[model samples]
Target: MPSLQALKRSARYELIRAGLEGTALALNFGLPLTNPQRGVIFALHHVDPESPANWAPNAWLSITPTFLEQAIEVCKEEGLIPIALEDLPERLADPQDTRRYVCFTLDDGYRDNARFAAPVFQRHAVPYTIFITSGFVERTRSIWWKTAQDLVMRTDDVDLSTFGIDTRVNIEQRAERVALFDRLANAVNDAENEDTAIARLDSLAAAHGIDPLAITEHLTMNARELAELAADPLAHFGAHTLTHANLTKVDDKRLETEMVQSAARVGGYVGAKPTTFAYPYGYASAVGAREIAAARQAGFVAAVTTRPGLLSETSGKAATALPRVSLNGFYQRKRYVRALLSGLPFRLRQT
Candidate 1:
């Protein structure tokens, strides 16, 4: 059975989809009267086409190589030039460069980013950023969300009574599996020690005869692959914390450690300090003035959040707390991509 939260989320997704469709139509017909003049930064995760089949509930996080290609093509068609995040300062400052710009950012340092997404961006000669979670690269932490999904898929059932879930989920049912995954993900997020939370889930999966760590061995880029990616001139590295923990939940010292250590670790691998940072979870709850100040203090040139809005001149003022438009899985159509870049939807929200 779908959890009430899942049901509500689905409803909200549908409503947002409808609004995006309408907004796309309006922009296409020039009904919005004005468009966003600023550049855009798109946030993405897991660009593989195959992984979504195994985890249906989180499919939104993965976009196919084809969709990525289409999205890039749309960006070109709409007269937007691709720029690297590092180039933003100069681009924004230049009075002569009139072309609107877009930057692509993929979080989580997924292996498929190199295997699939890189070639696509390379073909277009576009520069992009990959934010790495140091713990993930070190293989000291498992991606709990992926582990939770794998646990439900591989096991016949899951007992959740200990986690305050009243029922035993029948994993064979897709809806039940999704609900269980959601509950587990929430638990992991709320956990004081996210690594401990993931370890608990791993134990649960082990009891059911699955090794969650083994399952995720290929999910994220290993050290060697990261080194190779960092060698690419078009590719830039950014710190995404050490364990992908929610910054808002950790104490001041731990939060600073996560940010500073991650930058140092990536710097070690890439042979230079990472100039950018991406807050784990990236929402307002996960990041705020406190976290932003910490990132700046840690020496990041800028930090980005998962906030939905177009970039503007004023955006540069809040460099460490910048917003990004997620090219979400729910809206992969090229038209929707154009709509998002149009900035019409964000403009409408403001009024």
Candidate 2:
């Protein structure tokens, strides 16, 4: 039996799938007034040839390599050119250059990105970027999300009450696991002192026979691996903040260090200064005028957010904090990918 969360996700997926079908039909009919963007940038995460788990709670963070191949084909079929993230700001700046474009960017330097995603992009000759979070590559900070999932799934019951939850949580059933996963995620992200919260989780995982640091080392590509992947002409490397901290709550000095040093570290592997940035958790709250300003001050040519939408002339002006359409795990169909690029799903959201 599926958990309530799974059922909710299924219903939401169906709703968006129906919306995408409408978007595709409308796109075919040519509704330029509503869908005014000439191009889009795609946000992606894990791309692996194998399914990570049978009932993976974090499944949305991943996609199969086959889906990636189809994604490239779909963008080409739509008449959009595949470009690098570094070129986007320049393209966005030119009034005469109205050609539609698609840039692929995967965040946090995952191993699967090099193992599975790189081959497809190389085969298609598409220019793609990997935003490297230095701490993940060096195993200096916790890749808290992956660690949380592994700990909750492996242990039958978890006592996070010591971490400040009032009650001990059961993780035997899938539903129980989902609830605990969410609870733990909230505890960590929503905490006043996030580092303190993360330490508690590391301790919790250790108590339950899980190794948090090992999870980061295992999942992410190291400095040497990144250096090897950078040899591909089709590949570009960009900086994601060192610790993957929410940029908003951090101090100005810390923010600059996170942004600048992260890029410098990525540059060391790629043999050039990385000119792009992707904000950690790039949502409305995490990214704002301050973070955008910091990107420019850090010497980044552009920065991307997790905000959903297509790029237009008005939005392209603020190159530092640009929006991107997610190449979502739930809606991995080629038509859905086309629909996302068509700008119709986001258009429908306005009305």
Candidate 3:
């Protein structure tokens, strides 16, 4: 884990790099620079803080309910109108429609999204989208991160020699545990195959008496829970692919299966065919031209990437793979989020 001073310095550096100081002026003046006429899709994951400690390695995947509510208020205060992701294609296509819109999209169907985040959206009457990973709802895939987290927290020591570690590792201290989780994550991402990498993690977790799928069962909403939440008029559903696989690493057939079947599965639960999609892991390494093309081939009208950019006019030209700004869990402050929505940092040369 990073020390308080180190974390503060890193946060300050990011704010400066984002040109956050000028964001206030841009917003106050109603500069075109701060406008969201082409819209900004904010990528999010967990809205409920599952772990309160500083030792949480996946802390970036979560934000407090207070922060979620504050974020909604801040967006409205900054002159961005809340719109459903389903409306994005039409809004982007209309050259005459100049209204600035903010589309809140949460990836991975966490139960907290329905339990915690939904109430905030309901109270404010803001529209948002939840991208369901069907395997998670069905508890069929190993959510390696969550599994690793529990194993590290529960066990004082672990042996991963079979997974490339030369010796047993100890995680007595909080920082050591956090570091261990990060190391496990890096090993997976750096592996030749994502599933093979995950299999290794699963085996390691099982050796330590952890059931990876059970972690998924505990963390995510099931099919019935998803259906109940889908009943909310403010809540819209999108497909996030089955098993949340690294699309780039999988074969073409696997890619098509994940996309098409996941969308179909989510539609079955949500009672509406999902027209929009969110790529799993949504990064360049995970989702590329091939994955984006597959999303279009799967019949989605719009799909979002984790690529950090405010949507612009020409963005509509590529409706299938639109850029999105992550409401990163690391930077949950209203000020940082405000700067992101302004479209200034990306426009700045330093970025």
Candidate 4:
């Protein structure tokens, strides 16, 4: 059974989606009623077309390569100039500049980013930032979500008793698989020791006939690939913590270690310390004043949350708590992209 909070969130998202679709025409052409600022930071995860079928439990986290290409083209067509993340401060500082800008940021340093997405970005000559979790690149930590999904999809029955999850699930059923993944993923996210929870999950996955580490090794960039990506002029590396741990749950010492060590490791690959940071599982509860202060102390120039809103002059002041709109998998249509970038949906929601 889905938690009440999860159900409520799903309902809220559906309402927002309906609003975006309903007000698409007015938003695209009408005078802007929201913030006058003309810049957007897009957050994305997986960018490869792993399956032809678009419907999946984790579909929202991914967009096909074709969709990515079309999105960039749509932005260009709509007169939104592609700008590097590093250039955003300068652009935001210039109040006189009237041109719209978009900055691309891909989280998790997925291997597919290098294999599939990078080529598309390169062809379009767009600059992007890839936030890497050092432990993921070092293979010292596993992507719990991926491991959970694989276990749920591969086995008809799973014994999650070890994780204190006493739920009956038939993985063969799509709905059950999604629900199971949600429960397990949420548990991992809220766990006190996320690393231990993930390690235990990996053990369960191995016992059920799959090596989670081996499977996910190909999903994220390795140290060598990170170095290569950092060398690309179109690409910039950012810290996403050492283990992708939620900073809010850890003590001050551990929190600093996660932030500082991750930046240092990426610095080794990029030849300079990363100036940007993306909070792991970036949500309000996962990050707050403490995390923001830590990012500043770690010497990050900017930090972005998964919050949905447009960037404005005021946002420049709150660089550490900056908002970004996800190029969500559910809203894949080009018109939807225009509506989101318009800042109208978020504005109307506020009203």
Q: Give the per-residue Cα lDDT of candidate 4 at 121.
A: 94
Candidate 4 lDDT by residue in tens digits, 93-181: 67687777888999999988888889999999999999999888888887888888788877998876666667444566666776777
* Comparison by TM-score, 2 against 4, better one: 2
Runs of candidate 3 with Cα error greater than 4 angstroms are 1-37, 49-51, 349-351
lDDT of 4 at 88: 75
Best by lDDT: 2
Between candidates 1 and 2, which one is better according to lDDT? 2
Please list all clashing residue pairs in model 1, or write none if there are none.
none
lDDT of 1 by residue, 1-351 (tens): 778878898887887778789878877777653554667889999897774653366778988888899989988887788988867756765667556788899999999999999999999999999999988888887777788877777777777654455657677777777778888888887778776777778787777777766765768888888899888889998999998888898899999999988899999988888889999989988998899999889877778999888877667667788889887777778888878877777766677
C-alpha TM-score for every candidate:
0.93, 0.94, 0.90, 0.91
Clashing pairs in 2: none
Candidate 3, 64-179: lDDT as tens digits: 88888888888888677899988888887889977777899999999889988999999999999999989898888988888888888889989988687747987898777877
lDDT of every model, 2 decimals: 0.82, 0.86, 0.82, 0.81
TM-score computed on alpha carbons, candidate 2 = 0.94
Model 2: how far residue 250 lies from native, Å: 0.3
Better of 1 and 3 by lDDT: 1
